[model samples]
Target: MTTSPILVTGGTGTLGGHVVPLLRSCGHDVRILTRHPSTDGVDHVAGDLLTGEGVEAAVAGAATVLHLAGGPKRDDEATRTLVRAASRAGVRHLVYISVVGADRVPLAWMRTKLESERAVAESGIPWTALRAAQFHDLALTMVEKMAKLPVFPVPGGLRLQPVDSREVAARLAELTLGAPSGLVPDLVGPHLYDLAALARPYLRHSGRRRPMLPVRIPGKAGRAYRVGANLSPVGAGAEVGKRTWEEFLAERLG
Candidate 1:
């Protein structure tokens, strides 16, 4: 008997790019749901999570749905759309990728992440959600843009534990293949780096220097970040991914 394909949303993206291959290697048939169908040699299902178009059809006949599609906004709405369809289609497992500060950070995007998590849990389908730290790729992009400016304004008390996206994909692939485990340990990097610490390596790598201005991020969000609300607690047994910012920079810049 043939197994049903695992439906993956955002399979063309960075995280999904790493995950789909791992699943395929494990002998699982994978179907990728995307807005723009491509002939990239993977099974493609055209669908829009935000608009609910082709979503039901995408979930049809699939026993598992790995939801990685997200954006700066409307993530909660999109998750809800996917959850409803997945529930109706009797999807046995729904695995989601969320951020570490989804509940603690007082930010709009964080709120959306928390809401999305809730939707998955309450959808009645066996679900697994992993809250991961900022990806090194995103951190690199941020530092790259900041270095372009005349002066780099390092936010006061801002810190992050940037994990490797490939490591995250590996973990997600394990969760996707295993039985549902709700709200697993948060995945984070080995060490934490503040704003200046994150930028210095980039500057040295690129042979650029700029005046560093210390700026305070005023408001509840700033306070939350300063207090390390966005981090997994040190003694909380968070799953730490083995990769450093310097290692990432060396590989990326070299």
Candidate 2:
């Protein structure tokens, strides 16, 4: 079977790590855009998205561009640089992995994501933006961080549909293979839980019992989560992940 070369930015990340292998298994040639050029089965293109360094050669002749370069922290300039470079390189399709509630969230990080989505939309390239809910791993990380605090302050009454990172990666790879369909349905988990309630299991597993104080985060972002912006009840088809919060905690804690 003929294989098309697909360029994956942020190829070393958690989601990217899973995506790279999945694409290769499907008989697609994977070119990973990374700062360090490492020949680990897949082709590694050395580049930095912040300065638009080496992006031209990285994306050259690629059939699809999985734009997964943004950091959890905000950097508008860097994101804009990436969008411009991809557009200039004439990429066939751009698949952007964005976060859920980014559009309604007031947090700086979420706002930056929203802006990146906008840039992709206006770039004139065939693009598909997959907005996903909070990763199950991210929730675990939050629990660890909160454990260090004297009192864990979490968003009260906020319904979160935390999906597995692996599932999100699989969906992204499938989307990259096909044509861009601008703003695909948000991918959510099978169950919704309050932030504090979700952390309780992790806390018990870790043998650290701390006071869980739920607080209402006052802002548009907070409102979005409360109203289920992080969930995709109905739209595009969503794959239900089998791993639950308890399963995730047991594996991580053990």
Per-residue lDDT of candidate 2, residues 104-162 (tens digit): 65688888898888988888888999988888889888778878999988876577778
Alpha-carbon lDDT, every model: 0.95, 0.81
Q: Return the TM-score for candidate 1, rounded to 2 decimals.
A: 0.98
Worst 10 residues of 2 by lDDT: 230-239
TM-score of each: 0.98, 0.89
Stretches of candidate 1 off by over 4 Å are none
lDDT of 2: 0.81
Error of 2 at 160 (Å): 1.7
**Model 1 CA lDDT for position 188:** 98
After the best TM-score superposition of candidate 1, give how far the Cα of residue 36 lies from its true spot, in angstroms: 1.0
